[model samples]
Target: MTQTVTTSAVRARASSPALSGPGLFTVLLAAALPLVDFFIVNVALPTIGADLAAGEAVLELVVAAYGVAYAVLLVLGGRLGDLFGRRRLFLAGMAAFGLTSLACGLAPGAWWLVGARAAQGASAAAMLPQVLATIQAATSGGRRARAMSLYGATAGLSMVAGQILGGVLVAADLAGSGWRAIFLVNVPVVLLGLVLAVRYVPETRSPRPEPVDGPGTVLLAVSLLTLLAPLTEGRAAGWPLWTWLSLAAFPLAAAAFYAVERRADRQGRTPLVPPSLFALASLRRGLMLILPFSVGFSGFMFVIALALQRGAGLGPVPAGLALAPMAVAFLFVSLSGPRLIARYGTRVLTAGAVVQGAGVLLIVLAAWRDWPHLGFGSLLPGVTVAGAGQALQLPNLMRIVMSEVPPARAGVGSGVMVTTQQSALALGVATLGTLFLALVPHHGMRDALVVTLLVQLAGVVLTGLLSLRLPRTVG
Candidate 1:
């Protein structure tokens, strides 16, 4: 009798509504908010500092605080979704995100803003994993592939648009809100998302959800903080003793985390991030590709933003507009990705790398020859090709990473993949951003920019090499 009842319950849950197109749109909209917020502040940081009398270190915290909190809690959020419900957490997270944005908008001081931003990051961590997990549970085959592609499109476009929109909002100064408008703008969008989510989004959760892995969770948090904290804050904070100590502790924490997770897997217990998940050729190689690609992608974004604004004397709007070519190219190419992938398989990623490399080399030459006169016209060819290449790479990689994930393990798989990307993003900003800033003082802006592009090209080359090792076709 007990076995019969359990099987019936499983069937009932599986028979629930699959994700409709409208529902997919709603969840993808939710996914965009966090990423947008992550990059939105980049352009507004100078304005924020001037208005709040914030120094460099505090301003860095404004960014770092949000990133650290978002990353640390993501895997836990995924597990929670599996244990309770995805739609439930989605609504809660969206509501919390709205309130936190309001707090950030109204904050009167630097520390207050930092606190609010940290809370906002926590809210995002709660929200983002459900997007991928929900899709994984609700869709299959071609539908799943298309949804993942759209999600990737939304993510890439949001990162670029956030900086663009931030520039516009800060300049527009709606009712004289200035930089606060960047955050305040999220309120209405979140409100709309909540309404749609309640109406259209289907509820989903793991059929055999496991209890939270406490030891694995703690070790993972320690491992990330020990590494990311020092790298992000070390230069601005004068390389304090504590920062060095944290850096030294990272490898130890990481090793311990791996050991614990492996032991749990060996014992047939589900860990926060199961070591067993990496056995999939697609997931493993896909992640290896994503790390280098993300590092280069974000590093280029940060370095270029600084170069255009600080060195070239362009205002925020113009600086943001400079990437319009890339944005447009990414959108068009990504829309066509499914068709391309159907025909060419994973070789598309290799082609993307070659195109992106060519674009980077073009940018390097243009910067070298044009110097401070660089503008939209001079950068159009390079940015457009690079954006197309990125379009080809990012969406397909995301689809590949989760291609083999079972519906029951969807939440864990999504969480692990996102955590890896988020950590790489933060690391990119720390390492590449630091390198660019450090070089500028000695080598000057143009030389520093060129050198940075060269380094990014090297990373792109590495990604191409790694792509060769992936299974020739995705599931």
Candidate 2:
């Protein structure tokens, strides 16, 4: 009787609508939106500031607001999908994202843009988790692996392509839209995503859905705000007393959040972020690796945008074009990732780190040798090599992270993984960017860039060390 019931349950799950190519494409497109938006503004910030007469601090808020909102609300978004339906939340989030992007594009002042960006971030938090959750719930075996690889490729490419696209759009200045084009472009894409999502995507949810965890949710928000707010805005805001107070409160809030989660787990209730999930080696180690990698990745993107435009005297288009080599190289290597992972296991990630580190060294040497002459041609070799290295690691790391998570916990697991990555990206911008900016005045652009690259090299080495601990074989 027990065997019969178990088999029936398996059959029922297998019978649910599986994700097709079009469906996967749609969701991957959705996944690209938030990440692209995050980096797209890097090259556009100067234009935005000039056009709006915004100060340095307000411009920083424009970026920090979106990141903080996205990071803090990600877990809640995931849980909501598990409770209601992934497809439904995805559609609603997509629509809201479109509307918010319009608001951003139409903003009259700096504070207005900041508010719109915050709403856009919330919409992204709601939309992005469902992509991973849907993929987890609907596919299995090699098919799932392939979809995941594609998703990773899209993610890596989006970060680079975003800056490139932003430059192109800003240069085009469609109907005199200027810097606003970047935000406005999302409206049409979101509209298409909604249409396809309705036609192609399938709805899925946890069989035993749990209600929202109020205390865990509140504490998590507080914890993230306390940590990220001070770090991102402190330098721009002159390290005010409130920033210090917020930084001091971070540890306590984080600890309290953990305690509440632990208590909820013991009492047999769902928490916003379950502490027990970290017990899985794949998840814990994968996140550790992701943190350093994402930090270096985003920090480099931010720094390079600033350096190319301000230090090298390049226009927005030229500044964005400098990264083309990296984007192209990343796409090529990422496509070959699954086959390479099959043959070499997790060692591939270690190899990627080594290659990326070598590329970073090359970039540092080039910066030192050719400061004023730095351009697309000078950056070609280093960026190309680094992109190839990143391609090898990111998708494989994503696969390893989710390999052991059961389908029932898909939403939560995906939430946690994305939250970690998003938070690290923000941290990267805060710490490395702050360091670079501070050094530029005293040490000059060339020396400041060299020092930053060396620091990033250290992070790459740490990522390589962490990769060694991952499981030898992946599912």
Candidate 3:
């Protein structure tokens, strides 16, 4: 009789109505923090390099260190959340992130700052997977859609806002710390998130607990670190032999990781990432699309930020403000995303890709026409249109990816998706941004920017092609 009562109560909690108002707001806020940190540091890089007298390679590591650590540990973090409790991990991660952000703000040396940044990324990995997991476990149907949409919008907006906020803080030089202010600003925001989260966020985890695949976790981390670390830091560090070796080993490591996970799963063990998760066609294809989409997006932002500041002679503020049109356009179009997805389904994503491609083309043309005179006004239309296109796609893509993720596997699913995205983003900045910079010395900045935009256009086309494989409508 006691066992029956306990089982019924568990089901009741799982089937309860979705969070609303403050509860929903808290989740979305938590979701936005990692993305905000990702782009925020870009505009501050030059200032940091200047103030710290850091070399370009070390500076690139500062960014890459955070991203690589986050991407590598994400799956394990998710598994840990499932084994423990998402709320427990979320609170702990958020607290660590705040403290690390403080460390970043107060670092006296370049290496110390880099280490802190890595720690910050690890904390983000711990915190981020829970946002989506909690939403999945706690919400369903229309409520879930709304929560996911808000999460997507916050992500997109935060990416833009990070850069903008970084500029403002760097320029303001709060407490006369210059670029350090960008990180320092997070201290108060994080404290607030911690306070609200404790009050409003409910605890959640997999109802049927599963054992962590220890070996799978280790292998997965090795695979990601081997792949992402080199790709991100390689070009900046002049592509050492170890970088080439690491890249070469990626396929082997990935295949081995897969083999091990598949073996574990077949044995009725819970691999850190279950193969069953990919059985959902929408989730699989949606993740495929996310990779290229995120890669291009990050590449564009990183390359453009550098071009604007170093090439076009803009300050941090102006460079950051240049992305404002994209943010505005994204916000406006994203509000109508769900309705559009309901009507047109995956076709909307295709349309967004085409529109984004056009925007990139326009950017290429603007670069061609404006040459040395490229300015915020000149770049506005292209970026605005591109932002509109992205707004249409990103939210819908997110909805599709999470559509079929069983509540029980939500943590792992979110972890897998986010890891793919964050890894691709880091690589994009590393590869595309590297290509642009490499070309800048030989061909002028104008030509370099145009070429990079064209390459990104190809990525957008790939996204369009992949969209056809996505389910017509999300569950």
Candidate 4:
């Protein structure tokens, strides 16, 4: 009986189509777009506000809308890819993303940009899961290892590059388009991605795709929206009555969603996020680390961009370039992650968290001392160490999360993981960004920046503690 099962598995492996070299590159390029857009708007927000005559309230919406939409719909997007062809969904989503990006660039007002950004986020949700699913289904052994490592590296680098590139684009004001150039730039890249995808990317889908979990999907959506919406918009909108009510409803909605999903799993039906998936120790523990790391990372990005530009009185180029050392450190360190993991195991993550925490503290000290005079040189040491430490954590954490997820359930697994990461990102912006903003009026910009960095340092420490629980040796 065991021999027969082994033979069947071997035959299934033989029949799977491989993801070619160019195909892998195309999907990685696609993966980079959504993450890049998430951070790209940070440095450009001031310009966007001026050009559109948008207030702080409306400006927050521009970022929140996209993040909420992306986080809420990601799991559903993955399931759809499993039912339909991954390649088909990838192409369709890419087309929608391009169109929405065009709308964003052409938007005549603040509300128009917000709506377009939400649409763009939805499109990203549809496209990104397929990249991970394809990599899981199409590659194996050393090839799979290499591909996964590259995907992790790409994810980290793209995030840093997004902010850096945004600063440059806003400063350049190409074709006199100003901040709009940031969104408009995606148009040409998406067109190129679509062409490459069609010619090189292979189609893949689940062998026995389950029907969509309608109840679970709706409940999950409710749970996320109720929690995220009010938190992101509440302070900006003067903490309206609706925000409090929404916050009150969140726990109930979350409880209901969990109960429904659990019941569905027990009855041998597939839920949107399978309860069984977390049985993988690597995935479960790795995700815990990812949540805190992503939250702190995003919050720091948003706050630092604002602080350098407003408090330190730097131009967009200088504000963005202040983080250049971090980006360079991340890029170089990430290239060697696979080798480090092979030798050091999960210890890399713990040490990374310590290193990152030190960097955050250094920045806090700099802010306290330098105040309005903080520049690229003054901020160099902290950002470089922070970036190097982050390089160690994010890529390895991602590889660990997906390490034990079954190839057959790759779409859902990737979706679950990305959703967790994305939700934390939104929360980071809402929570830490709000804290920083709230403090600025009372404590002054310098004090607020210091306090925010200290808070982020605590998060880094928590991430280190969580990393201790991850499987000693990842798959």
Best by lDDT: 2
What lDDT does model 3 reach?
0.88
lDDT of 1 by residue, 1-475 (tens): 9999999998876645599989999999999999999888888888999999999889889989988988898999899898889889889999999999999999999999999999999999899999999999888888999999999888888877887888888888999999999999999999999999999999998878799999999999999999888888888898999999999999999999999999999999888889888998889989999999988887888788889888887777887888889989999999988888899999999999999899898889889989798878888889988998989999999999999998888888888888888888888888888889889999999999999899999999999999988877888
- Model 4 root mean square deviation, Cα atoms: 2.2
lDDT of 2 at 214: 96
* Native-to-model Cα distance after best TM-score fit, residue 124 in candidate 4, in Å: 0.4
lDDT of 4 by residue, 410-460 (tens): 899999989999999999989999999999999999999999898899999
What are the clashing pairs of model 2?
A: none
Model 3 lDDT-worst window of ten: 13-22
Q: Model 4 off-target regions past 4 Å? A: 1-15
lDDT (0 to 1) per candidate: 0.90, 0.94, 0.88, 0.92
Clashes of 3: 0
**Lowest lDDT 10-residue stretch of candidate 1:** 9-18
TM-score of each: 0.97, 0.98, 0.97, 0.97
- Which of the numbered candidates is closest to the native, going by highest TM-score? 2
TM-score, prediction 2: 0.98
- What local lDDT score does residue 164 receive in model 4, on the 0 to 100 scale? 90
The order by descending lDDT is 2, 4, 1, 3
Show where candidate 1 strays beyond 4 Å. Answer: 1-16
Give stretches of model 2 more than 4 Å off: 1-15
